[model samples]
Target: MRRFLSLLVFLGLALAQGLSEVWKAVEVPGGICADGSPYRFYVSPGDPRRVVLDFQGGGACWDAATCSPESPTYRRRVEVQELLLAQGIYDRLSAANPFQGWTHIFVPYCTGDLHVGRATVDYGGFRVHHQGARNALAALEYLFRNHANPERVFVTGCSAGAYGAVFWADRVLATYRNAQVALCGDAGVGVRTEDFPGFRVWNPRLPELPGLSPDPEVYQVYLALSRAYPQGRFAQYTTLLDGTQVFFYGLMRGERLPSEATARAWAESALRAVTAPAQAENYTFYLAPGSQHCILPRPELYTLRVGEVAFLDWLRALAEGKTPPRVRP
Candidate 1:
């Protein structure tokens, strides 16, 4: 009976695969990786009119110490590429996933540039190609040409990818004029203006905010996008105490890692600044209590709760044009 049940489960998965298109890689000639290989993306078809574009995240590198060939940040690009080729949390077809039936596009990050850089730089003796923005644009153009007119779109990413999603929300909205768009940045908050002096290295053309300084924080970027597109919804999620962000910030500042309590305080303060204003009514956030870095890639994505609402349910409400409660634990 056990063997029979196992057979039944295998058959069920096979049937599901038969109905849904498996993630397939497609190369973009204009997109190039940091190592100079052709860039590629993975696509799994569902309801073409409803699409979920996910940007893959690793770490990022801007200077010699971080971008060197032997640096751990540089190696993350290879790991991210390998993971994108395998079936993982984002590729699951479980009923718990709000985007189970939506068309999925996985944008791999291998440029060591957080999917926003636009230049090639020589770091010490190593030449690092920082063409992340161009690669993303090329893949987006391909989607616009082949799968135009999506009615609903969700742009999301974890860690570095989360920054990409928030940073590029305006461009995504511009590409799909008729779509009801939503942006979710998981574990991508807590970035300060000073943490990003390397922005000059990426040289991305950021959105214009009238009163903001020339170099703005990531939260400010989200605010700017929200005010610019009132018709769209914006959401962000992160652990109250994210060690990964704390470590990254420390590295950028050349200091020891901040305490978890200090990190949580910083996150809360930044979040309040963004969500307190009347103009931020369309923006919401979920801050869970933990030292975890990302929520979307874990089982918590389905089981995690904020008050009386499940995270997945809250996300579904956002996609359905309903304003769910803002959770900050």
Candidate 2:
């Protein structure tokens, strides 16, 4: 059964990859996707570390014709059942790609282009895919079976992806070694769990938390992953909020919903995320003087000129053996 499945899967993958040169639309499995089809990310394989599977989101309820099982989106999400791939933040041990000594996988959860106010209630963009991080992690796991024994593996996002970066990285890091991860948490997600484990968050020690995002597993994942490696420290940071909190993504300003208490909740999560790490090497946060969402997209908004670039540098430092500052968030 395994061998046949493997052959079938391999053939399917080959067919999908080949389609890039020839076909466009294809059929899909039943009950697997909303549209009953699959898509692929089109990333090159042979990675030593986990694969970076970015999930593009936008409340785009594309018709069956718009998306299909044989498409890049579906293939990327499903491929890996038979391979040695894993996701959710991992050490970029030089082996993944002989060319790039190190490169982290960022499986952002947001699907469609998330343009804040321009959107409407008809399309609850934020709510449509709040748990994109979870899917990204799952895809990573699916791709890298070798991820089970990581040199290191991790997952993160950009705008709505921050929560995913924090939650998945902390969970996998707490357990995996040589782990360093970051999320450009654009819209600030709120994290709170009533009965399960809390999340491990990292951002600069700004005057306030970004917003409170409720999570059911990030914190728990952190504790579980961290329990295996007790000495690993978390590398994190945040930029200053020059009155852009509400405009960017506070509760009062849902980046999607908008609310003051909501923004406060986000800030609260920021505080908890930094402090969530229990060990000496655990949580760390950096509060840039003034910053807002998508510095990578709009670097001009950062108090520290190189907001997003600096964050990636920190990830590199964490991977290599330097005790990058987790700062006092």
Candidate 3:
């Protein structure tokens, strides 16, 4: 009986692939962009038992100068077509894609709150709505409503969205209850400065995660989630010297442009941030050597490799409920 059910699922997925899936926009009430515009997320139909919830990362801002769209700090809006344009894991045509026939929920980031803020701030006259948590929650609820009992759920994001992936993985686990939920944070190794604005500015309603500080670090989410969900897999992927991460760290330090010295400092901090999480049995990391930021949304997901392990293979293992060995520089 079980073999017959499995064969039926395989045939269903094959038919889904044969149909050439396209993204469909889902708009929920209370979902709004940072610019106070109507916000909607995109979903692509695929195998009903497998789902991928991806958060789109542009950038983030904390103060008035950075918050201004003119400053080029973060994305203040989202477009429906961006999801269809992304090539890597989202590329349904590629045979190398592990998630080719999985249901995809593309979560666009515009709240500048790392997808976990709840406060609104008026920087002088320009009001910025930091309701990332609200927007993300609405999207998650939509996933819960549509996919009641998935076999697997891949929670992931790049850059700012990577942080979102970690922040929301616990909730995904809670919703699925019986599903194999895995988290992969692409290029969002949370390495921020001491002076970086904590939770006070954005005022996120944090989950009841033990070991998470009042002003939490990115690794805290990793550690907390690993302990909280031992059966679930949690992982991170980042370049050894991520230029964008260094650039953002420089911004927190009041530098308009980061010096080479700042890059070195960022590397050290990033390495230290991964230390504790790396020790977790289920938490793994892939630290490739380069300055490039994100890979999951790019072609590098298939071609890039470290040592003997291809990134695509490692990611496939993670999505399939296997704890792939970590690859580090």
Candidate 4:
């Protein structure tokens, strides 16, 4: 009875939060994206313009790497950190400094793993470059078939989620006919309170937080993804390569630089479709100054509590084939 009651409670919250269904509308059970992948899509009743695919753990995709286990490594990468924050430990971290609270939310949006299985497309692992195109294709098809004609559609996640957004834009060119991906804390550049890249990468004033470390192994997954895509998508990148912390990702210094360089070097990379002229006007890149990841890209410019208003402008521009204005903060 307790288990059944818990299940009921869970279902109630999922519906209320609009996680599983929409209110005042026929509940169309979102399938594995008409393309046939085991992923889930959530159309928020609060805002249908907002379609969150629930990747990184919220979605039912078999790609497990996109979300993470109970490791800080996963937090720094893209995983639905809202799950982590519910835990007592994350609460303490929040109590420590609430202003920087979203870092917990933004990181997963950037570097979460990208793995998609089933027919149509199967790369074995998630590659932002490849996954971007695939996801964009899925999005385009869905839009046309559903006839959504939505004013704006944005994909967001923490850590890994953020990374996927950046990867999608960096890898999938043309910005998609009706969408623009925003990779929050895209590369987690200046998120940490302590470190800063280039000129400085550490917060000497504050002691290094124990148990925090970079998971370069995560790069292996990215590298595998990149190797499959000799040609990338976006004309530029918004890597959060801020120097505040080197926990999950970092600079491209010396021989180790090629990997780091890819984030910005995306513009020069190739794309899948041939016969492409210059595409400079299609995309814009923004970097947070002091953080290691996408925790705090431009706080002053983007209101945390304002919800999706700020991002809608850019989304509208991209959807209409107009270049979204660059955000220089």
> Which candidate comes out best when scored by TM-score?
3
TM-score of each: 0.85, 0.47, 0.91, 0.37
Q: lDDT per residue, candidate 2, 218-308, as tens digits?
A: 3333443344445554434444332333333332222344466655655666556544654545434455554454332332322232444
| Model number with the top lDDT | 3
Worst 10 residues of 1 by lDDT: 78-87
- lDDT per model vs. reference: 0.74, 0.36, 0.85, 0.30
Colliding residue pairs in candidate 1: none
Residue range 145-227, candidate 1, lDDT tens digits = 76788888888998888977877777787777678999888887745535566788878656555555566677777777778
Residue 220, candidate 1: alpha-carbon lDDT: 78
For model 2, the superposed segments whose C-alpha errors exceed 4 Å read: 1-39, 42-138, 146-150, 169-228, 231-233, 242-279, 295-313
What lDDT, from 0 to 1, does candidate 3 have?
0.85
In terms of lDDT, the poorest run of 10 residues in model 2 is: 198-207
lDDT value, residue 186 of candidate 4: 35
Q: After superposition, how far is residue 175 of candidate 1 from its true place, in Å?
A: 3.0
**What stretches of model 4 exceed 4 Å from their correct place?**
1-39, 46-71, 75-112, 115-144, 148-158, 166-185, 188-245, 250-279, 295-329
Clashing pairs in 3: none
Off by over 4 Å in 1: 1-21, 74-89, 193-195, 208-213, 256-279
| Best-first order by lDDT | 3, 1, 2, 4
